[model samples]
Target chain A: MKNATITALNHAMATRQPVAFAKNLSDGTEFLLPDPHAPEALNEAGRLALAADKSTTHVLGSESWFIEARNPAPRLVLVGAVHIAQALAPLASMSGFEVILIDPRQGFGNQERFPGANLVNDWPDEALNQLKPDMRTAVVTLTHDPKLDDPALDRALHSNAFYIGALGSRKTHAARLERLSALGHQAESLQRIRGPVGLDIGSVTTPEIALSIIAEIVAVRRGGSLGLRVK
Target chain B: MIDVEDVLSIAASWHGAGEQVAIATVTETWGSSPRPAGSRMAVTTSGKMAGSVSGGCIEGAVAETAQQVMASGVPKLLSFGVTNERAWEVGLACGGKVQVFVEPLI
Candidate 1:
């Protein structure tokens, strides 16, 4: 690996832009992906590796190249500092997510209550706007009140966040969807939310619910199936 | 060359300082390998090392190979573990096998 390759890959990572480093094992040739100068064959292989979010070996005829995908760290934005948020924040962090808890209320969003989380003291919409949730982000609205959860969900719906979850019952989710519909969110986009958020593991306690939520987030991120249990 | 943690930026800083450096990455693993693929370790000419390709099983040999790679400006793919034919060549008595790619940071 040349210092030039390391510098370019580091630059891409520092900028939080996804990049793939391709190395030809047989010839010791190295190149960065998304480079117009690189051969089209390697570029396509890099594209596939990045899209799959993994490091893989691609063979073209007799040449084999290792494509290492380096994407920005995944982030989990908790829109309410409720009980579930307290339980879920650390779990998300353990699961390799940069957990951020957003709540304007000082008492709820304080560092003492939720340790090891980036706390946002602004309203959910403002916080989400400033945070600029991207494709690597997972957003969850833990406050059941429409005043708090609705705006957060609205902002999340507009962003490129890969996972959007809300803490509520099935009936609560129906009403929440109706309110979002009134705000002009199309039905198709609204379907992206995993309401009554979390997989169906018959969770009854706060911790169990939090576990279910994290499991569901992991399931979505890994492209795993929930079958009928999610309903 | 040293087994520890993921320190890519640190390696870049060393390269910026004009130090000869080499990086080794665990590209493949079999059976009960201590570290999974993508684990990395960086070594400098001054013997400074960080990160681990395994749970310290083959870092010493990798560090030595990294210095050679830095000197030669060439890359090498090394395999270790009891399963490999030359497993004892590097002192990886562990049961699983791991392939590490070592290259100079030129």
Candidate 2:
């Protein structure tokens, strides 16, 4: 195996992109398939490894190859440190997401409320700008205040965030969508937002609601059929 | 939080420091293996080591093999399971089978 494959693996790890490393066990030939410098068959296998987030042995004609997947960890960006955020933050963390809570309110977004969390005291827009919601990120806006949620939602829609959610009632979500539309987000793009934000698990309390949202997030992440399971 | 193991970066830095290093990964498992596939252990020829392919079952053997791989620049694939005669040597008596792939960290 060449040092180039290792270099590519470390580079992908640093840049937080998905990559697959294919090794021809027979000859010890190496390829890192972020668009491999190899045959088309290996590319197809690389794609499968990436989609499965798994590493395994595959046969290509005569040679046996091991495909190793290095996928970036999922991230959850909560735009409010409300009661639900308090519950959702830890839940998402436990479920394997780097949770970052953003709230400009010092009192609410403090370490006292979110201990051992990556808290951002900047405005939602500024926070999202620095965060750069990628394909592995899930952004959830829990603050019902239009002033806070709208900007975060706007920034999220403009990016590649896999799951975008907003906490509100059906009526509030309708109004929120209209406001986003006025900001020039097309209807097709705006449709990406899962307003009323959660699986319809009939959650009544803060923790249950947080569970519902995290469940939906996980579903989308795992490509489960229950993804975007809104009422 | 996301579970990012520090072992790979440690190995890379060790290589950067001019140490000869090798990486051992649990590439396959059968039955109830202690670690799943993709678990890794980094080994340097000077007896420096980090991470584990199998929880605690075969670090010593894997590290020894890693050192050999570094010296020869040849990758090695090893398989281990509970065998009646060798069960006392490696304590995977009741556990599952595991295949480890070891190669130099070039």
In the predicted model 2, the residue pairs found to clash are none
Most lDDT-accurate candidate? 2
The TM-score of candidate 2 is 0.65
Candidate with maximal TM-score: 1
Candidate 1: tens digits of C-alpha lDDT, residues A102-174: 9998899998897757899999999999999988899999988898899999999999998999989899999
Q: In model 2, which regions exceed 4 Å deviation? A: A1-4, A81-96, A106-135, A139-231, B1-4, B82-95
Per-model CA lDDT versus the true structure = 0.83, 0.85
DockQ of each: 0.24, 0.24
lDDT of 1 by residue, B1-106 (tens): 1113346767888989989889888877778788766678899999999888888868999999998998888899898867554556766565697888899876
RMSD of each: 5.5, 6.3
For every model shown, what is its TM-score relative to the native structure?
0.71, 0.65
Q: What is the lDDT of residue A66 in candidate 1?
A: 72
Angstrom error of the Cα, residue A13, model 1: value is 2.1
lDDT tens digits, residue span B1-106, model 2: 1234566777888888999989887777777777777778888878888877776868999988887898899899998887655765765465578888888877
